[model samples]
Target: MVREVLTVSERAPWWRAPAAVTAGALPCLAFPAPALWWFAYVALVPWILLLRSAPRGRRAALEGWLGGAGFVFAVHHWLLPSLHVFLFAVAALVGLLWIPWALLVRELLGGTPGPGRAAAALVLVPAGWLLSELARSWQGLGGPWGLLGASQWQVAPALRLASVGGVWLVGLLVVAVNCALVLLITAPAARSAALAGVTGCAVLTGAVWLWAPRPEPVGSLRVALVQPGLVPDSPDSPERRFDLGERLTGTLAGQRPDLVVWGESSVGADLAARPDLTRRLAELSARVGAPLLVNVDARGADRPGIRKSAVLVGPGGPTGERYDKMRLVPFGEYVPARALLGWATSVGKAAEENRVPGSAPVLMDLPGRPGVRLGPLVCFESAFPDMSRHLARGGAALLVDQSATSTFQDSWAPAQHASLSALRAAETGRPVVHATLTGISEVRGPSGGRIGPALSTAASTARVYEVPLARGTTLYVRFGDWPAGAALAALAVYCAAAGARAVRLRRPGPEPSAPPARTVRGSAGRRAR
Candidate 1:
C-alpha cells in the first residue's frame, strides 16, 4: 500500500507544476560564480513538466509558492547574517517574501502549459518576478539581492536583451525557452519537437547578436570617484565634515578630471545649510580644473527634512540640477506607520528619520563636455531599472551612480552593488560611472562591458576613468515595463479562464478527469545554452 501511494504521488498532476517551477528557478543561480553562467540556463525543465501536468486552480498556486520559496531561500540566504545583526526577530520572519512569487508562477504555467499555453509564461512569470523584486527592494522589509535577472550579468547573448528591454526581458525569454522545451517534449501530436525548441532558442540568440549595441567611442573624459566609507558626521557641526571634503578635493586636484564625483554622503550635511562646504567643493572644482558632482545625505535647508540629494557644481557656480532620491528604503529611510506600529523605530535608526523621497528626475550639464547632459542616481537607487531608464529616455548622454557602501565594509555587498552598474549600463545603452564610498568604483560601457578597476570598500582611495558618452535612447529606455507587464497580465487572464473551465468540469463528477500518458524531457540535464 505504501509503495502504491508513493507511485501515485510520483504520477500526480499536482506534483508536476511545482517541480517544473522549481526547475525553472535554477538557471538564476549562475551569479557570484566560480560556477559557469551557461550551466544555469538548464534549471527550467522541472517547472515546464510540472505545469503541463498540474490540475487547474489552487494546485497550481501551491506549486508556484513552493517553487518560489525554494528559489528565494537559495538565492537570498546571504541576508541571514545582516538581518540577524540588526533585526533579529524580523530577520527570522524573512520567509514571508516568497509567498506571492510562488502563486504567480503556478498561475502562468496553469492548464497544461503546452505550446499554446506556454507562451504566456514568458510574460507572467517575469513580470511577477520583477514586481516581487521591486517590492522587496524596500529597505525596512529587506534589501534587494540576487534579482534573477542579475544572474546573467556576464553572459553576452543574455546581456544583449538588457539594452533593448532591460534585464527583465532576458528573464522572460529564458522562462519562455523552458516552457517551449517542455511543450515540445509533451507535444502529444508527434510534431517537430526538437526542431521547434531549437528554432525558438536560435531565433532569440540570433536577434540578440544582430541587434546588440556596439560602442562608438567618443572622446574620453577623465573623472575621479572619492569614497570615504562609514565615518559619521553630525549636521549640527557642519565644520566636522568639511575637512574630509577638503582632503578629497586636495588629492583629486592632481588627477585633472573633467568632473569629480564624491560618493553618497561624501558631504555629510546639506551644502545649502552648510554653505561653507559648498564653497570648498566649488573651490576644489576650480583647483581640479573641472566641475564636481557630489551627493548629500542630510536635510535640505529649504525643505528641512529630506534625507538624500545629488547636486552638480561648476567652478563658476551651481548648475541648479539637483536630484532628490525618489525610492526610499523602508526601514533605513522611514518606518512604515511609526506612530501606530511604534516599535522598530525606537531601537535602530528611525525609518522615517533616515530619508525622504525626491520629487522629480533631474539632468545636469557636464562641465568639460559642454553639450553632454548627466543623469544621476544616489546609493540604493541604481538597482532600479526604471530609474536609469527614466534618465536615459530623457536624453541624458551618460549615467552617474553615487553610493556609500561603507556600512557593508568588505563583504559581498560591494560586488552586488557594482553589478547593478553593469546591468544599468546595459539597460540604458549608455556608460555608467558607479562611484561608491570606500570603494568598488567601476565604469561600464555601452555593450554591458566593464572597464577599469574595482576599489575596496574597506579602504580609502580614488581612481579615474575615460568614459564614452552615448546619445539617444534605446528600446529599453522607451517601453519600460510594458512587455513584461503585458506578459504577466495575459498570464493572469489565461489562468483565470482556464481555472474556471476546469472547475466547471470537476463540479458534477467525483472522479477527476484523466489525460492520455505523456513523458517530458528537455533541458533536464546540463547541456549547452
Candidate 2:
C-alpha cells in the first residue's frame, strides 16, 4: 500500500505545472487595464489549490516558482517592448522567491488538515506569501509594483486599512482571505476554521476603518498639469517636445494656478549650460503667475553624469531648489551589474549610459506659500511606498510624481503607473499629483479618491485640478512597516517550533537489552537439571 501510494504521488503529470502557471496569472486581472478590483479577493484560489495538491514537496516548489514567474510576467507584460526576451529571464529569477512559500502551503494544507492545521494555515500561508512579496520588493528585484493590496486602490475600506498599516498590512489581509477561501473550497472538514478566519479579517478591517485617525481637512491648492502628449519622433524631437510644453504652459497664463507642474524630461538641456532655456522657463513661470516645476534630463555641468532633476524655476531663472532622481529603473535607466549584463543594451531599449542617483529626498516649499511643501518623485520612484512615506514624514504637504512614459504610452504600463499614486496618497494621508508627459495625468485626494477624470494617453492638453490638502500623521507613516515585521516574527516562531518538533521525533529511545541475558540464563539452568 505504501509503495502504491508513493508511485501514484510521484507520477508527474505535464498539465499540472501549466495549470499552476495559468492560475497564477489570474491575479493580474485585478490590477489596472482590467481594473477588476473585487476579483483580487478570490484570484488566488486556483493557485492555492494547485499548490495544496502537489504530490511531493519538490514538485510543489517547482509549481510555486513557475506560478511566480507567470504572475510577474503577466503583471509586467507591458515591459516586453523595452526588455524584450530579457523580461522572461528577469521574471524567472525573481520567481525563485516563492519556493519556500510553496513548500509552506503544501505542508499545512496538502493532506486532510485537521481544524488546528487549518486554522494555522489561514495565518501562516498569508505570512509566507507576504514574505515572498517582501523579498521581491527589493529595488533590484523590481520595486513594489502590482502588490496584491494595490489592486484595491479604488476600494474605500482598503484605503482606510492602508492608513493603519501601509500596503503590507493590506496585502497580508488580502492573502489571508484568499487562503481562507481556498480552505473553504477544498477542505470541507476545515470549513468552520475558514469561516472564522474570514470573519477575523472582516472584523479587523472594520475596526481599523472606524478607529483609525482621519486626516483633517486643512485647505486646498490649485495646481495645473502640463501634458505635451506625444511629439513625433525626429532628430529634433527633444527641441520640439520642449517647444510644445512651453506653448501649453503659456495657455495657463490667466488661469492663476498656485503652481505649474511639468512631467519628467520636459527640459532637454542643462539649465547652467543653456541660459536661454532657463530664461524661457522663467518667462513662462512669470506669464503663468506661478513657479514652474519642470524636470531637466540633461548632463549637469556641476555633476559627473547625466542627471534627471526636478528643478524649480520661479520668475527668476532658477530657484536653486532642485531634486535629483534617487531611484533608477532597473533596465530602463541602467543595466544592473553592467559588466555582466551589458549585453541587455544590444537586445532592447536599455539605457546606454547610467543616470546618477540623488543623495537624499528633498522637500521644496512652494515659493509663495509658507506651509505648502512639495515632495517630488521622478518617474520610477513613485512605485516605492517608503519614498513617499519618508517624504510625508519630513513634512511634505503634497506628493508629486513627475513621469514620462512615452515609451509605454500604448501599454498597460501607464495605467498601472498612475494607479500607484492612490496607494501612496492613502498610505501617507496626503494628496498626490501624478504628472506625466504623454498622458494619464491625475490627482488623488488624501483619502485616495480621484479628484477628477484622468487624462488619457491620446489627449494633448493641460488641465487644472482642485487638490484637497490635509494635515495629519497616518499610522503607517508613524509606525513604518509593522506588518512586514509582524509577518517576519510569525514565520520565525513557526520555523523554531517546527525545528524543535523534528528534533524531538528523531531522538533515540531506551535500548531493549534484557531479553538476551534471560535466554542464556534459562539455557544454563536446563543443562544443570
Candidate 3:
C-alpha cells in the first residue's frame, strides 16, 4: 500500500509579522485626521499581497490576526488615554475574527491564480472581509467605527452608492477594488479579469448615482447648534458645562430657529430630578422661540442606574418624548463582562458601573410642525447603521446625533465621530445634525453634502444652519442590510463548497482488491502440477 505525506513548512520570517501589522495599520490613514479618502481604494493591497504570499494556511491566519489587531489599535488609538494597556488586550481578541478571512484570502489569491480563480478572489475575498467587519461590529466587540466604506464620507460618488445599499455595499466595493488591484499586481494571466472587476464597481456606482431615488427637497428648517467648546476640568465642571450651553443657547433669541440642539451631556442632571434645570431649559427654549433638544447624563429618576438621554424641552417644559441611549460605549459607558474583566477599571479609566441602556428608539414630533419628526441617537449609538436605519424607517425626517468625545479632544476620535454622520445621512437620505460638546460639530444634507463649516474644538459659540429637509425613503432604508445578507450568503456557499471538496479529498479510495488466489497458490500449484 502507498500513502501520500503532507509536508509542513518552516515558520515564517519574524519580520513578516511586523510587516503585516504595518500593512494593516495603513488603512487608518484613510479614515479621519489624515482622511486620505482616496487611499482607501488601495490601502488593503499590501495586506492582501502579504497574506497571499504566506507559505501555509496557518501562517496566513497568524498574519491575518496580527494585521487585524494592528488595524483595530490604529483606528482606536485615541482610547489609549481611557483604556490604557487594556486596549491591546481588546485588539488581540477582536483580531481573531479576521483569521478565517485571512485563510480565505490565502486560498484564493495564493501564488499566481488563473483567470477563473482571480475572478473568484474578487468576489469571495471581499465577502470574507465584509463578514469579518459584520462580526466585529457587534456592540460588545467595538461597533463599526473605521469601516472601510466610512473613509469615503467626503466622496459624492461613494455617498450616492451608500444611499442605495448603505455602508455595507460601499465597503464591499472598496474591498473588491483592493482585491482586483492585488490580482493586477501579481497575476498577469488575470489582469483583464481584475480590470473588469474594477470597471464593474465603477459602473455600479455610476448607475446608482444616475438612477437611485433621490430625496426631494420638501422645505428648510433653521436649526441652531450650541457648542460650548472646552470647559475647565473641575469638580463642578458639569454645572459649568450646563451654564455655558445655556448661555450659548440664549444667544439664539429672535433667530426664529425651528429647533435648538445642545451637545451630549449638555444638561448634567436629569430634568426629572432637577426641576430648576427643567424650568431653565424651558425658559431658554421660549427665549429662543424654538424647542430644545438637550442631552442628559445623570442618574435616572425612574430607573436605578445612570442613563444618558435626549430630552425634548418645549416652551411649556419637558415634552414627554425622550430617547435614552440604547447603545453604550464599551469601556466608556461600561466594561463588558465586568465580573470577569472588572480589573480593567484599575488599569484605565474604565467605567466603574455600567449605565443602563434604553429600551427602544423614540421619534419626537417637532413642536408645532405636524409632519416633521426627529430621531435622536446618543454618542456611541451614532456609529450603528441599523439604529439610524430603524429611525428613518419609522418616519423620521431629521437625524440628530448628540456626541461627546472630550476625552479624545486632542486625538482623531472627534473627527472620526463627526464623519460618521455624513455616511448616516447619505445612507438614510435625511439631513443629519452632529452636535458635540467639545468640537467637530457638523451638519450634512440628504446627499451627504456638508451644510456649513464645522465648528472646531477651539470655537465656543452658537451657529444657526439653514438645513434642507428632504422627503421620500432611501433604498437602503427599505432593503435593510441586503449587502450584508448577500455577503453572508456568498460566504456560506463558498464554505459549503470548500467543505465538500475537503471531504472528497479525505475520502478513502476504493480498497485494493485481494490478489488472485493464484498468487498464494503459485508455488504449491507448480509443485502439485
**Best by the TM-score measure:** 2
Relative to the unseen true structure, what is the C-alpha lDDT of residue 489 in candidate 2, on a scale of 0 to 100?
Answer: 90
What overall lDDT goes with each candidate model?
0.67, 0.91, 0.91
The global Cα lDDT (0 to 1) of model 1 is 0.67
TM-score of each: 0.77, 0.96, 0.95
Candidate 1 wrong stretches, greater than 4 Å? 1-28, 33-36, 43-63, 66-82, 85-145, 178-195, 212-215, 229-245, 346-354, 496-529
lDDT of 2 by residue, 42-143 (tens): 999898889989888877888899999999999999999889999999989988998999999999988888789998898889899999999988888888
TM-score of 3: 0.95
Per-residue lDDT of candidate 3, residues 1-529 (tens digit): 1111123223466688899889989999999999999999999999998999988787888889999999999999999988899999999998898899899999999988999999889989999999889999999998988998999999999999999888999999999999999999999999999999999998998899899999999998888899999987898999999998998888889879999999998888878889999889889888889999999999988679999999999999988989989899998898888999999999999999999999999999999788999999998888899999999999999999999988889999999999999999999999999999998999999999999899998889999999999999999999989999998898898889989999999999999999777545677788998
* Cα RMSDs, all models: 12.9, 2.9, 3.5
Ranking by TM-score: 2, 3, 1
lDDT of 1 by residue, 318-374 (tens): 778788887776566666666765466555554536567878889987866777888
